[model samples]
Target: MSENIGDLFQEVMAIKQAGEFELISALIPYAGLVGLELIKENAGLITILRNKPSNIGNTTIPAVHGGVVGALLEHAGIMHIICECDTTRFPKIINISIDYLRPCLGTMDTYARGYVIKQGKRVTNVRIEAWQSDPSRPVAAAHAHFLMG
Candidate 1:
């Protein structure tokens, strides 16, 4: 039998584990908000967040807000939990940490990529990176740690 994507997170618990914005729009509102009317339902997070123009996102002076950038990172990582998880249940966010490297420049779009470094029975570890101009010159990167029910 083929593996149903929904079955991946069948045992997830915690309100935060409900990662998909479309699943509970009222509850999540903007699970992956990008400011410029972002789409929160796309399953291809790696490409979805690959590169977003700074124009679409909020900008502060010459750079974007630190919080907004961090959201982008968290959003990218959490998307994986939602897309791969089964509707049988929801997954939750336990703890996450992000590090800023470069300035999110204005007028330029940015890109982000997320990968699952590890997925344990009770927790998941993900790594994400956001870059502008050059992928090698990343603007921000993060390592996410999530908890499951």
Candidate 2:
């Protein structure tokens, strides 16, 4: 997988056109493990969904794990950068900071969007927001920076 970023990018494009969001997990295995799916793509915006029982960390509150939320945001951000730049090299995450605003209901499917705020020759910054039911009431938000070459 590390040696085939270009191939993966091409596959992603085909899947996007076909509206086969489920196949994204197979093309990007980490996404498969995390139950991440590309739901929509148009222009420069992309939406991601994650639904898996293993993602829930607090059974009492039925809340998604903090780590899982973080992974979803980071994964979305990386995919956005890849699709935007169409680069052969996989972007390396430099740093990220996530803010958990509310409890994400475990029984619901969570959706996220990663917006590319700025892109330079070697670095890209992205803003991510996630919600379960209402986009206006996001459960978490994050900012990520990636080193692209």
Best by lDDT: 2
Candidate 2 total steric clashes:
0
Clashes of each: 12, 0
Evaluated at residue 140, the lDDT of candidate 1 is 93
Error of 1 at 54 (Å): 10
TM-score per candidate, in order?
0.62, 0.82
Question: What digit string (tens of lDDT, one per residue) describes model 1 on residues 17-108?
Answer: 55443343233435434432223435444423323454334544467667777877777677656555432345467777889898787556
- Candidate no. 1 TM-score: 0.62
Where does candidate 2 clash, by residue pair? Answer: none
Candidate 2 stretches with Cα past 4 Å from truth are 1-22, 41-45
Give per-residue CA lDDT, model 2, range 1-149, as digits (tens): 45846766567678656767556667766777767876555554445556678889999989989999898888888877766665657789999999999998888888888888998888899999989889899999999999988
lDDT of 1 at 128: 87
